[model samples]
Target: MVKWVLALVGYFIYRFPGAIAGYLIGTLIDSSFESNKKSGRKGFDTVFTTSRSQNVSPSDFELNLLSLASIVIKADGSVSQTELDYVRAYFVQAYGKERANATFKTFNDVIKNREVSAQRICTYLNSRTRYEVRLQILHFLFGIAQADGRVSSPEVSQLSSIAGFMRINQNDFKSIKAMFVKDANNAYKILEIDKTATDAEVKKAFRTMAKKYHPDKLQHMDEAYQKGARDKFQKVQEAYETIQKERGF
Candidate 1:
């Protein structure tokens, strides 16, 4: 009985430490792996900011869509060097060097070979990405169009078609377009003031207009009148934002 008891004690002692050591080793390995993976992901994200966007698969239909919009931007028989450069830069930023270059070549070839419909591109994008993503994509496209410091009519038309394809409500698209056009108006005139206006004067002008054209208050007016009021109000707000951006107010 004594020998048997001693043998059992010896077995328990060996197994217990082995189990504890294994658990400790497993936990350490797991923690180390997780930490390394997190660091790697952070590194990748940092690189991605500088690298071109390559998230979309080559087989995805958005590629053709983007190409068509770009072609339309240059449709006036005169694609400015600046515009071409902007397109190249954007693709590079989105896809990285090699892929971006390849995609650009494809874009060039596709634009020459076929006439892809802008509406179809938008529709495909809308079906692919969520509404919010579509909005962001549209904003990026707009940024590209404005990169040349001048937005062409074709670019505007392409954007309008994109908005329609994204299923952005007609009213919202109209509102946004009006805002863009009104913004192109003389900033000083939009504020109903001049460069001579003091900081206080600018602030007062903005406050008066913001309150007068508040969308909430416009609800009581006729729909058409309300839209007009809102557009005017947007101009005033944009004027203020512009001045703020320029540090004029």
Candidate 2:
């Protein structure tokens, strides 16, 4: 409508060239306005969706962690008090006494019902969490499984299955398992290095493992989770020390 009006006015005032120029200018302005309106809607939708998704907070993370912990604890067809204590201490340390007491009931119910599936939880976590964070979670689960002094074959199989669902690499899963499974008895495996490697290669592997498993890398996590990472970091350091002592380095 506006373009036709502009063109007619232009034709009366200055004939063909003026009509062409006016119509072109009007069409350009109309197209640009429509494009901006569409972009505005898209921008708003993006912001709203992102904010909604990011609403998954640290407490939510802890809940999911506890839920998955329960599943892992029951993997061997038994649930030990030691494993439950490990999880309880985690919540108490991370969420404080009051919150832990409140959340424990839910954790207990989840365990009693046996309704949560490890694979489903792992799938959800994989979709939502970063790889580093998922690795840390796997480390935590291994710690819980070993809290009773040993990680059973069934528990190891369950951990491996969870890692697979989480899209964690097999080598990375084995690296974490080596830290806890003493039956392997190989510091080289703990450091994830070749037995025949030179001292320099061993030192390099230690540094790499140290950096990758550092607790500080998990500062964004809850304090309890950070403590779990610190424990793993110490284990890595211990493995390195053991290698150095045995090799007389």
What lDDT score belongs to each candidate, Candidate 1 first?
0.53, 0.72
**TM-score, one value per model:** 0.48, 0.73
**Compared with the true structure, what per-residue lDDT tens digits does model 1 show for residues 47-86?**
1121234333222432553565565555555556666676
Best by lDDT: 2
lDDT by residue (177-223, candidate 2, tens digit) is 88888754557777788778899999999999899888887776567
Instruction: Give residue 56's lDDT in candidate 1 (0 to 100).
Output: 30
Candidate 2: C-alpha RMSD to true structure equals 19.9
What 10-residue stretch in candidate 1 is worst by lDDT? 42-51
Clashing pairs in 1: 52-93, 52-94, 52-95, 52-96, 53-94, 53-95
Q: Could you give me the TM-score of model 1 versus the true structure?
A: 0.48
